[model samples]
Target: MIFFDRVSKVYPDGSVALQNVTLTIEPKEFVSIVGQSGAGKTTLLKMLLAEEIPTDGQVFFESSDVHDLGKNEMNELRRKIGMVFQDYRLISGKTVYENIAFTMEAAGKTDEEIEQDVPHVLELVDLSSKIWNFPKELSGGEKQRVAIARALVNQPDVLVADEPTGNLDPVNTYDIVQILKRINDIGTTVILTTHNKGIIDSLGKRVIVMEKGKIIRDDKQGKYFI
Candidate 1:
């Protein structure tokens, strides 16, 4: 389980990004976090990855405090989480296969493992036919699929998608949402941060509403209400 024990974050300029926020995410649960810009959604995720230090309290993954981990321990912890972003951060020069393989290689997977797992993840995202295509040759949705495939190649325990469909058309957005649902159904915990009300309403999962860095509401099987 992931826990934020009264976590708060204040920047160097004394701007409060998060204020006394506490949250818990259980394994295999799909949760969506909705808020306007600067509502502290991204800051919350950063704390999970230890990219930002909390001003008070602690963030814990399982039993270990995320902020107190040593370098190697932190690296191991991060290996179990995958991240997707609004802009599909793919290498322009590399083929889809290479892009996914790069992640496995970094984790010290064997060549045989990369060869085996890359195609599996691509198939999961329905991008098997575009394995050799470069990012420039694909559509926006396909690029994001590639990004998702890259993120999942390692089979992370948690998938964090931040505005993944922000750049896609309605059709592409639906496709991506379906893919996310499928990923969740397969048992990986999904934590999504998005402004698309339609997506949020369609999900009908747990909704976490945040305002001014404080969680205002949390509902099981909730809709999009700001």
Candidate 2:
């Protein structure tokens, strides 16, 4: 339930991040975006998150104009979307449980709710035993799993994962992909941007290929071909 209409983004120093890019992501769909660096994938995700304003067009999330929203309204819109990054942005001092609980607390979830949901989500990511572990105490895969759990704690309608497997080994990468697929099967829309061709090929999902700020190919059940 997202739409981009003739969207373009031009930075102040004359760099174009996106040009006439138009795309739509339906509810409960798993879509993968693939391209080299500077292909505007990050800009597209930022536009959806309302972190970047389009230079010449509009972005809509389920019929609401994302760029037109006020500050409070934008925050409300963002609550419906969750983001996971490559770096595993977890708090160094917080334990696995606390990291997720912190996100729930910010979302106004009560202590009881956090207690119940945190363990459930950790179980979903297969990180139940690591509840008391700190970020530095975990492996890269465990850290990424914690990040995924944190992102899912709020149960957002869409999950945007940007290069989530970039830092992990192959086995960990495969595990993360399977976890994402499981999330999608449960009805959350997933938008993934990755450079790994084998991952894209194994996914066998809708693929969008971008080059120099434009979508050059969009294929259903697509491969990793550039």
Question: Best-fitting candidate, measured by TM-score?
Answer: 2
lDDT of 1 at 151: 85
Q: After superposition, how far is residue 116 of candidate 2 from its true place, in Å?
A: 0.2
Assess every candidate by TM-score.
0.97, 0.97
lDDT of 2: 0.94
* Each model's lDDT: 0.93, 0.94
Question: Which segments of model 1 are wrong by more than 4 Å?
Answer: none
Residue-level lDDT of model 2, residues 168-200, one tens digit each, is 999999999999999999999999999999899
The ten-residue window of minimal lDDT in model 1 covers: 75-84
The digit string of per-residue lDDT tens for model 1 on 106-220 reads 7889999999999999999999999999999999999999999988989999999988998999999999999999989999999999999999999999999999999999999
Estimate the TM-score for candidate 2.
0.97
Please give the RMSD of candidate 2 to the true structure: 0.9
